[model samples]
Target: MTSRVNPQQPSGTAPVVPAHRVVVLLFEGLQLMDVTGPLDVYTAANEYGAHYVTSTVSPDGGPVTTTAGLRLVPDLSLDEVDFPVDTLVIPGRPDWWAAVADTALVAGITRLADRARTVASVCAGAFPLAATGLLDGRRAATHWRLADDLAARYPKVEVDSDAIFVRDGRFITSAGISAGIDLTLSLVESDLGPDIARKAAKFLVVFMARPGGQSQFSVRQSPRHPAHSVLRQVLDQVAADPAADHGLPALAARAGVSSRHLTRLFRTETGGTAAQYVERIRVEAAQALLEAGDDALDTVARRSGFGSEETLRRAFRRRLGVSPGIYRDRFRTTRPHGTRED
Candidate 1:
């Protein structure tokens, strides 16, 4: 059998050939889901004649035990590898912050950063990347719980907690475990085109193609009581008509409560002011329209309560790291009979 060319193996090249070199990093207490999620997806790409390569690496050339007691053997030591890597990925560990404080792990990551075309992390693996100073002043994302810490520790970096994954040039970071699959499939798509990525998504039975900006947990509120169903109903109403300039006064009237009491109640229950909650709902609504691929950008923005495309773009950049147009192109669904893929 004649082997085909693997384009993704060479760093920074347009992918015409299949992926040639992909490396994954493993460390002590790594999350089993993070390591295996990308690994499984990439392995499928290889089966389809993607001509990919994968290897595990460790700082000391030994088996690294995971948080779940699964030990992974590294193919190469931190000092022994010489292959040109197109994509270098690091899996998240349970106590990633503690591990990152270790100089050896940080050095291993920094060395890999020097050679890889694209350097990426899953969840807390971002801690090491942040420590490496590769993400300074760059747009990135991580698990929501760590967002504040990542921001405070790496004061130079801008962290968006809502995104499933974020790409800052060649540096990529993903949220918790499952999002790693989303990010990896996206990488395949970016390298080979949407067709291959879609195929991989289908093969994995995962929704690799999704629209909308990353929805922030800060925007979602948990109800304090089953009796607070009234408040939930009001939220639903606001979500349905975000473009309407409904205010605390109007919302309180609808909920049959005084505006002052309603404000205090919302803050107590959701940990956010009513206005902040409304903004989150509106932004999320706008994201849905943009991802749907049915309406014009301006129309989507208007309906989603953004008022204008420019407003939507600014919010998207501030929150999602990429522009709205790019986000739509990446995650928007094309109508099978009528829309074009490219």
Candidate 2:
């Protein structure tokens, strides 16, 4: 016999629920915000008979301390738990990186991932997901600071530092702290529908639905003063023509500096290499195309420096975890300059 659950009732108050189970993995020193963000999102939707039953799970059902020192007691341990999980959420823990590497927590997470229908991570949690080998050959996103490391460490996984979240089939990942909320909202939208997701975002008072194309943080670094004339001129040109295919050599030639020198100067000034900074500019331009224009895929592709429609599709899949058409359909509006970003 099968049992059905009333979404209005909290978990364990009734018989076994056929509702979607969302298990949040709690390792020692988990980020409280990451854990709470999704919990809050699902909690808000529960009143409408759209419950996403959630729980905190640890390797041992013992008490664990969050990064903020709040003690959390999980409902189940890895060995004792047997819930039908539709989604497994791994919250970030920056300080626990070394500890996770030294412990069996990551291995246990990998095991849980195998059993769940979908696996998600917030911020630094991508480290463990990558460690589990689940992210290999998939497009994933993590906190910007950790993106290079995630990509370099797992060469098979294409990492996008700019995305707020990446949803590669069943595996979803988001950038740093607050981005977890955006990711959760996206999940809510997917599970319940856009109306519920919008309501949740509104209840939380988050301005606008954050489109996956919007950068985790904008790269609007500008010169401090007119005294920095030449650099500022180059920056304006780059901003105006991000599709111009300018690399370190070409940019350096335009700026009258050696490529090596230009790279060093760019890193020193912008806190990123010339290539990294230029890519940021290109991504910003891509966002414009996604939001502003209804140009065909090939036209948008060429304008965004992705070279071809196929190339844009590959990057779009890796960065946003969806195709261009789907993204536009979900977030685009017919009004002039009516984009999700706006």
Candidate 3:
């Protein structure tokens, strides 16, 4: 026989709920920030109300030392976990590929993920999840530096290196260290509500929501290989003065090369035309100006070498999938009252 609870006369009543169980899988030589960042978000949420209960677990339930030489004791062993997990988090190690070779650990992760409502990984932690075959046929994100490597190693997974975090079905993966905080804040927003998530973000002193994707933070350094010195010099100059005339003839004149040679050499050495590279640099500069202050679009356009607000808008939309105004609205940092703009 099945028992049914009464549903009548429940107006203005708050329903009692048990806290969501969050389990973090700990391992030796993992990054410390990956564990602490997301955990701090959950802990902060507790201040608002009892929304989540967090626990750390290891394969043997023993003390594990981090890559930075800090030791952490797990709250439980893998075998000791008896409750269903509402969320499962895995933090990454520097030598993450080596961690993927542990068959027993992979089996344990698969088992837990099977019972978890949601599974997440931070940075290189995606390695272990991909190793479990759970991430196969799914979209995922990881540290931008390791994105190509992740794709090469796990051809079955669709790796989005540009995304800060990606949620595919029950799985979620985040890019590098601090991105873990953003990913967890999003999770809090999903599980609780945006109001709680906004409060948590305000407490952390971060944007209630960051704009753009990992592309904004990606390194735009020139290639290290020695190929075309002229092209490299031209690229550096463009970066230094995006507002300067960087037409092919001007760049070629500055680099002491013919326009034909410059264009060919840039394509051969950088895998993109000189014009494309200059446009990307300009867009990046514009993104920075937008994030740092409340500048008018026209001012930002002139400073970023776009020369006009309409050009900046088109470039932003073509590259970043968002408008300049929207990007600024989401990413602009709040300035203190007494602080002066330099």
Identify the candidate with maximal TM-score: 3
lDDT by residue (131-165, candidate 1, tens digit) is 98889989888888788888988999899877878
Across 64-171, the per-residue lDDT of candidate 2 in tens digits comes to 898899988888888866766788989988863663584588788878998899899999899888888888889998888888888887798999888888889999
Q: Candidate 1's error at 204, in angstroms?
A: 0.6
Per-residue alpha-carbon lDDT of candidate 3 for residues 148-176, written as tens digits (9 for 90 to 100) = 98999999999997788888999999999
Backbone collision count in every prediction? 3, 0, 0
The alpha-carbon lDDT assigned to residue 284 of candidate 2 equals 60
**Local distance difference test, each candidate:** 0.75, 0.74, 0.81
Q: Give the Å error, residue 79, model 3.
A: 4.2
lDDT of 2: 0.74
**Better-scoring candidate (TM-score), 1 or 3:** 3
- List the candidate 3 regions with Cα displacement exceeding 4 Å: 1-19, 48-50, 79-84, 160-164, 190-195, 207-212, 216-219, 247-250, 253-259, 333-342
Candidate ranking (lDDT, best to worst): 3, 1, 2
